[model samples]
Target: MRLSLLDRSRTRSGYPEADALHHSVERAAHAEALGYHRFWGAEHHAVPGIASGSPAVLLAAVGARTSRIRLGSGGVMLPHHQPLVVAEQFLMLEALHPSRVDLGLGRTLGFTEQVRRALRQQTDDVDTFASDLEELRSYLRREAPVTARPVTQTVPSLFQLATGEGLVTAARLGLPAVIGGPVLHSPELGEAVAAYRRDFRASAETPQPQIIISLDLYLAETEEQARELALSEAWAMARSRETGEFSPLEPVEQIREQHWSPRTTSRIEKSLHRMIGGPAGIVVPAVERLLEITRAEELMVSTSTYDRDALAQMDAAVADLLT
Candidate 1:
């Protein structure tokens, strides 16, 4: 299976938020050395747990640090920015990194009402996501009314970070789809993928339908160890649902010490169940099943934990398993 990574630059409770960005850069260099296919960064605005708000800027740092690994946005939320500006930022990245950049676009609005207002985004802005994507594509292909700067012969590869109706939009546009979250586990997933493939229209950049499955993955020498590793992220997710604030990851022991409400406990259990985490004996087969079902071209690992060392070890182990 082709393997890649999506680092959200998650902040740890004890660490400065700036460290998350630095960690992402260092992790990109490490992923390149490990022979991963791509190293993608995420964009999350006004989220306390996530440090990266500008994937373009973060990828610039990553590009300077790594020579070979593909760099991309895991992705850039389209509702918050104008299509032309998005094109220019990624065009600049393509100019610097040449053929190593990918533009993964999403239709998500801001995380909260305040953040939405801050970013000058409204709920209805999502209505233009498909058209905005077409405009961005035109700029990348140098076919728009106003060309994006740093024009080059090669354009960064484009992928739609999608679910539900977004999948239909991706199919209509003939772009690769990067899918994750609850939709992956839904009973309709197979039908959804089939429809995406059936409805895909050929385009200059992508002649065939492509899918990349992304999810939280954790690995360790034993199931217990792996569960412990995955708990940090699951806990944070559960807390965020309850508090409406996604805070930095905390150590397992710290999390264990805290009282968990029934809802939080249930949410954490569900989150952990959704993620693939265990020793190779377990994770490999689970991943294989997912690939067989989705027939995806790549597996984009989007795992994060409070322990950086453990996360690095997991990355190496995953590379050994997949690459």
Candidate 2:
């Protein structure tokens, strides 16, 4: 299976926020050396735990650091900006990096109401999103009325960050789908993917349905050690639901020192349960089962932890397992 990474530039408690971006760039270079297929940056506005608010800008920095691994957004939330402007920004990335660029678009609005207001995303109309995608594709394909310049010969591969109805939109548009969260664990996942493939309309760019399963995955010498590595992210997620702020990741020992409510404990367990973490013997079969169930073409690891060194080790281990 093709292996990729989705680095959110996660900020840790003891470090400055800027460190997260630098870490992400460093991680991209590391992944390239390890033979990863693609390295993607995520967009999260006003989130304390995530430093990257602009995938395009982060990708330019990543492109400067790495030569081979494909760079793209994991993705860019389309409702926040004009389609033409998005087209121009990625077109410039394509011009600089050539065929090493991919565009993963999402329909999500800002994280909260205030963020939405700040982004001026007033509506969540599905039709508008579909139209904007078509418009953006026109610019990328050089078929729009006005050009989005630095016009390159190839368009960046388009993917839809999808769930539920988003899968239908991807099928209609003939684009690849990247799915994660509860949908990946849901009992209906097989049916949903089968439906997506059955209804997919092929285009010259994508002749068949493609799915990329994205989720948190970590590896270590033992199951206990791997779960410890994943606990930091699980604690952060649990706290986010309670405090309404996704705070920076903390060390596992530090997390254990804090008092946890029953709800928080339950949330943390649920989060960890959703993720795949363990030694290669345990993780590989689980991952293979997922790939078999969905017929997915790629696995996008979105794992993050407070220990950067451990995280890097896990990345290398994952590369060894998949590549």
Candidate 3:
């Protein structure tokens, strides 16, 4: 039972990057010492809600700072970038980190079709996404059956990052994948696990099913404090449902400032059910419940604390669970 962290690069109510990066680098350094096995950062472009815009740059910097913990994208949405460019950049990263790098590919543009058009991609994007993923896989295998220009032979291992059917494809392709969704709820949990395991194909790259799942977190000193953090994440989750993905941490005061009809609050609770409370006594049990339900290979908890004080408390609670 390994416990890892996912840094979604939340803006923390518009915290300065100069400060956040300094804190993140220092925090990741501490995470390495604290025995966290892997630290996954994320990427977002044109989203003021998240600060994790340049995942590659951040990982490289974090890679330089620490030597042991594995690092990579919690996911780089495949539809947004050229597969060739991704292969080359990751190849370079592999040259630097070797076995320490992990690539999780999501099929999203990470936004809407309107934004997809904004990114200059076409309607055929999702249709071509799978093939593009295969191209990236073929390049990494360093053995494309055909002689193709723009081959990727640098990275030794590349894993697919997906949820739903993409998880099944990752199995068929025999790549390690992390299975999850923009949200985690419902009995779809068992089906998702079964889908990945049932259709697993033995390929030259991998012979067994390898998987991971995201745990929406709120570990803190007191249950009340935990609920407060959950409130912030819940707010983000509600916004994502309306706006497409997780937004920055809103000032709870500001959120309270808005007159939410009872309808909105009920809608949010129905969606983000698992993202409540702290680890003081409940963290381990919530995780155990998740594991009992999903039995994922790894657990990546998502936290939405506003500042270092909250992060430190959450980190310690998580550390206690790890020990």
Candidate 4:
């Protein structure tokens, strides 16, 4: 299978934001060296744990640090920005990087109500996501009634963050759908992928439908060690859902020392179990099962850990598995 990466640029509990940004660039270069297909950065706002607030800016930095590997947004939250501005930023990136940039658009709003207000975005914006996407495409293709700045080349690829609705929308627009790994585990996987394929309309850019599965993945010499590396982020996810603080990642050793209520413990365990990890013998089969079900053309792995070195090691191990 073709393997890729989506770096969240996670900031650990004691680390500064700069450290996380630097780690993202370092990870991108490392991913290139490891022969990963693409290195995507996510877009999150007002979140302490994630530093990728602007995917285009981070992608430009990553582009300067590496060559060959594709650079892109895991998704740019489409509802939060003007479609024209989004197109221009990515066009500029593509101008500098040539055919190596991707524009992955998503419809989600900000993480919190305060953030939504800060962005001057309303909940109603979600309804316009499809129209906004069409507007963005018009500018990219230079077919719109209006033009922003001059766009010299065509946008490399347009990707939609997959939902059942998103899968259908992507097909209608001739864009590839990037499905979360957890979505593939659902009983609805067959219908989702098949519908996308069957309903896809051929456009000048993409003649066929494509699906790429993005998963949280890690691998270590032992299953126990792999799970340990995954604990901090897993706990952070569970805790943030319960508390709404979205704090930075804590070390696994520190995490283990703390006690949780039964409900909290259950949340952590469920999140941890949902993650894809362990030695290759275990991960390989699970991945195969997913591919059999979803027929995804590529796998994009995302992992966030307290230790940068361990994260890189885990990345290398995943790369080795693909070979």
- How do the residues 1-323 of candidate 1 rate in per-residue lDDT, one tens digit apiece? 68999999999998999999999999999999999999999999999999999999999999999999999998999887899999999989999999999999998878888998999877764388888899889988888889899888678999999888978999999999999998888889989999999999989889999999998888888888888999999998999988899999999999999999999999999988998988888998988888888899999999998999988988999999888
TM-score of candidate 4 to 2 decimals: 0.96
Better of 1 and 3 by lDDT: 1
Question: What local lDDT does model 4 show for residue 46?
Answer: 96
CA displacement after TM-score superposition, residue 57 of candidate 3 (Å): 1.5
TM-scores of all models? 0.98, 0.98, 0.87, 0.96
Report model 1's TM-score to 2 decimal places.
0.98
What are the clash counts of all predictions, listed in order?
0, 0, 1, 0
Descending-TM-score candidate ranking: 1, 2, 4, 3
User: What is candidate 3's lDDT per residue for 1-323, written digit by digit as tens?
Assistant: 77677777667666674555566666677778878878887876666567666677788888899998888787777777877667767766777887787787777564566666777877654467678888877767665654334333445455677655677778778877775555246567777767777888877767888767776677767776666666666777676766576666776677778766576687567545666465446767776777776667787765656656667667766777755
What is candidate 2's lDDT per residue for 169-256, written digit by digit as tens? 9999999999998889999999999989999999779999999999889788888888899999999899988888899999899999
Worst 10 residues of 3 by lDDT: 147-156
- Which is the leading candidate under TM-score? 1
Against the true structure, candidate 1 has what lDDT?
0.91
lDDT of each: 0.91, 0.92, 0.70, 0.87
Please state every model's RMSD to the true fold in angstroms. Answer: 1.0, 1.1, 3.1, 1.4
Global fold similarity of model 2 (TM-score): 0.98
RMSD of 4: 1.4
